[model samples]
Target: MPTILDIFKDITKLQRCSGNHSEFIAYMQNLSQKLGYICLVDDVHNILCKKENSNAKIVFQSHYDIVCLKENCVPEIIEDEYSLSAKDSTLGADNGIGCSYMIALMYERFDGEFLFTSDEEIGLIGANGLNLPINANFMLNLDSEEEGEICIGCAGGVDIKAIFNNKKIVPNIDNLDLYEISISSLPGGHSGVDIDKNIPNAIKLLIQSIKGCDGKILDISGGERINSIPANAKAIIATKKQPKKLIDNMKIEKIDTKSEHLSIYDDTLLNYLYSFKNGVRELNKELNVVQDSINLALIKTNIDEIVIEFSARSMNNENLKNLKDSTKSDLEKIGCNVNTYGKYPAWNPDINSFTDTILNIYKNINSKASLRAIHAGLECAIFKEKFPNLKIASIGPTIKYPHSKKEIVYKDSINNVFEIVKIIAYNLK
Candidate 1:
């Protein structure tokens, strides 16, 4: 009998961040038992709950994992008159609201299947490794952010990791002044959906700030996840000449160092990172979406090597492959070892009887509803390949600035979408 807000607030209390969702998985397992449903949990933590007595032929799908900007972050819910958000943290409403809607339908005893996926924020991990059988003929995904649009297709994606191992260790002591340059407080966002927003990447900005310093890099690290645009970066370097403050919004401080050995990398490292394309590459005029894009997501300095990660996406599978291959070749040309994985296929836009029915239902509640495809990756793309005959469509409430601390969801949109979903569950049954 709990309302969707009550359920969402309860969900925020749990620690369900991506790659750290054991607590949320346990909660779903326990909830399915309490609701007298058949719960099947896969190895990758994908949950499928089925209601046997009802004759509904549809399944509701949502990823249970969320993105965390900070380590061990569990956002505290903050609500106003119009929307629900978090206190300086991501609200997890992107898919948490979707999960809440599925739970509400379960409480109503809707005759349908509910699928909760894991590690979606990192990549479509659970959806790609989904081993559980889905007997439903239709799938309704509740992961789309906008309210009035129905998503019929989504872009494919791949994760690339590159490692540079040839750094020179210099034993010169008492040489040049050591300075630590850092960039912070930039507006970071979701790499996939927010690539076109023109938000400044902290790593790129930091590199540009120190590009002319001609400094020997000792240590450099930045970025939070492989799927997010970096908002903070720091580097310690040794320079002979004092560099003037070039860029705003960054700190340049001379620090006293006692270390005897410093690792110095070639200027090509900085040149490659600066020249790398980090945003939308092409536009799909017909779909009015980004045809190809790449995010230089994470960079880290290890004891012996430096590693960089990227998330590449495209609206077509062939374009995705081409992008991945070209990026790999580019990294290899720089004398770095490259690897690519976590690849998912693209979902081509299609409209069938099921989509028409869902579109009609949505248009009834809001006459402005329309069918569209997104540039970001969605689990529906994987489901479409897994079950060729199964019809799939995605819709959700209005969630703004997802995957960032500024994330918020409108209260009215949540309630309106719930009403439409309720009608779909009952009438389809």
Candidate 2:
């Protein structure tokens, strides 16, 4: 039997995300054969493995899908201890770490149900599909971020996609060209925690500058999901006439960002205007710690108007609010209409969780005790509603920068989280 870290590494090799996990699901079933545990797959591909005689039932939920594959997903052992690293692609640590953690428990003697669901990325389709028996009394969710903290509550989120009813923008032969205006290089991060970083929205700022330039608005594309901060966006504008004073005009004067010319802007003023709004630059003084953030989530445009979707989040709600408010106000001041939607409540943790029975076992093993809340979404709220009598606790080791290209789970955290689950499965009431 492979160790927890080894299992984690193996999982990284699977492509289990959204519409892409059927193969990985089969692989997980194959592993179950070694432990004499028959994996049951639901119509929706949710998998459950059960040990019948266990006194209490603790279900661990995780998704088998990854957001996407990096350019070259060559898995390599990092730090020599264990776990795999990939080039440019996401390591799928967001929930793959959770899957490996639960898999470890299912094989060995366990005191409860091991639940590994799918479709968590696109939506909570897998877990959302389950019809549980009344006997399922407890849940320990490992699909959380950070190392020591037990996730008690989570924000309920909805991913929004809006398309502008745009007519094709015909370029002006008099002076029409596909000019690319982009806000690049800002440290994009998880939409919830990093949203409050006061970082510039690339699509939003770009639209403002492009609009200010008053060249014919042609085609605009921006962000993808409401959950992610858009890092880079490109747009094309037609220029039958580029005024000289547009970028420096009174409208977008407050933006501290820059712009360039692909000969797309007829007005040199648009260049000077863009030169002012250098949007989305990294100001992280702590190197990789990511103390700052930006929301460049989406970009879209129509012949008449351009729309960019943006979300801002910070561990600090006050700061998050301030940044969001500022961005909205600034955009509107420049005549760009801004709207907000699909807002959810943030999940704050109770420092004193009664530790329940899980904490005692975690402590007995001398593992680090982590008590923190993160800026991500989970089913904690839904689970709490469905099983109000059940005591809920969530813990996972260092899965960082979820929902992005930089996603990775620390191999060491996988080991630590697996051990924690083992203790919970053994001692759950």
Candidate 3:
């Protein structure tokens, strides 16, 4: 039998980035059949592997798709004395480790359900569109990042898109200086969990740099994904004068280009992005976490249109609605076409018999183990809604800097959590 790290290495070889996980899906299905488990894949590509004659009460769930910073990213695993990471790419350990644990349990012929979801990084696409039936009374989500903590609830989120027309004007080549300003190498992170970390957003930074010089936009694009805080952004502009007071952190380069038309876009585009309510809106003293927050995720310019995408999250549904409504109203007020989709509901905090069972088992191993909720969106929230009667709790190995290239997971934490998972699988009957 392969160790967890061995299995993880095998998983890293498959390119499983979001919107590009068909290969991994086929791998899981094939592996399930080889392991003598009944494999069922849904229309949305959520794979469920069931053991024969298993009476276990809990289902293990993990999303297989990962956030890839670059195109066709297959992480190169890097191992140190105590932890595992990737070589200049996202490790995918956030849920890959979770999936590895499930596979390990299957090798033991553990009696339970193993659900591998798809495209979770883009939005909970797999969980939201999940049509497969789950008979387990409890679900153990393996997506949480923290190790000594069990998550009982998570923030719901919606992706907001705003688009507006741009009028182009032929630029007077002699008077304006065409330059490309870019920002990169900043520590981008998961939008919801790291919103309050003061990590600079590359899109926001690039805008601020251009706005400082009052540059006329020619073309602009930034951000890697909707759920990730942008680590890199760049823009092209026509300025009457060199940007005098540019943001010091970004890279500025003078690009000599032939004459072209500059964008005569609405001032509201800059104002909306500059003044948009970003970061933490409220602090939940009760939960000691960010209650509401939004990320200025992505920006792109077409020949005649500009599109902006943002993600908003809150710990409860009402607050999420308010956040969505206010953002929509603000965008509509600016005469931009706006739409919201990929919205998932919040999972209210609860402590049920199943959670108590996991909690007690976790505490027995690590006395510091505690119950908490995160500000980030988790597929468990969708599963809780889809399977309301199923008691759910989430746990995972210690992962730092998820959704970014700097992601790392502690090896000891993986072993610790695996021990707990094995106990849950064995004792739950």
Which clashing pairs does model 1 show? none
Count of steric clashes across candidates, in order:
0, 28, 0
What is the per-residue lDDT of model 3 for residues 47-138, given as tens digits with 9 covering 90 to 100?
Answer: 98987665667899999999999989899999999999898889999789999999998888788999999999988999989988789998
Candidate 2 residues lying further than 4 Å off, grouped into runs, are: 52-55, 69-84, 132-134, 166-178, 182-187, 197-201, 208-216, 239-296, 300-354, 361-370
Supply the TM-score for candidate 1: 0.96
Lowest lDDT block of 10, candidate 1? 240-249
Task: Assess the local accuracy of residue 324 in candidate 1 as a C-alpha lDDT between 0 and 100.
Answer: 97
Pick the lDDT winner: 1
lDDT of 1 by residue, 274-391 (tens): 8887899999999988999999888889997889889999999999999999999999888899999888888999899988998899999899999999989999999988899999
lDDT for 29 in candidate 2 is 77
**Candidate 2, poorest ten consecutive residues by summed lDDT:** 246-255
TM-score of each: 0.96, 0.71, 0.96
lDDT of 2 by residue, 1-429 (tens): 667766777777665656665777688678767675656788888777765454546677776766653332434434344545445445667777787777776666565666777766555666666664435667778777777766665544433233333243333445343344555544345675455455445555665657665654445565545556565555666543342322221122222222333223223323322443322323333222223233446656554544555544433345546656666666554545566654443344433333456666666664666454555566555566566666667888776666655665666666776777776666654
What is candidate 2's CA lDDT for residue 147?
70
Q: Model 1: runs farther than 4 Å from truth?
A: 171-174, 241-248, 258-261
Model 3, residue 3: distance off in Å is: 0.9
lDDT of 2: 0.56
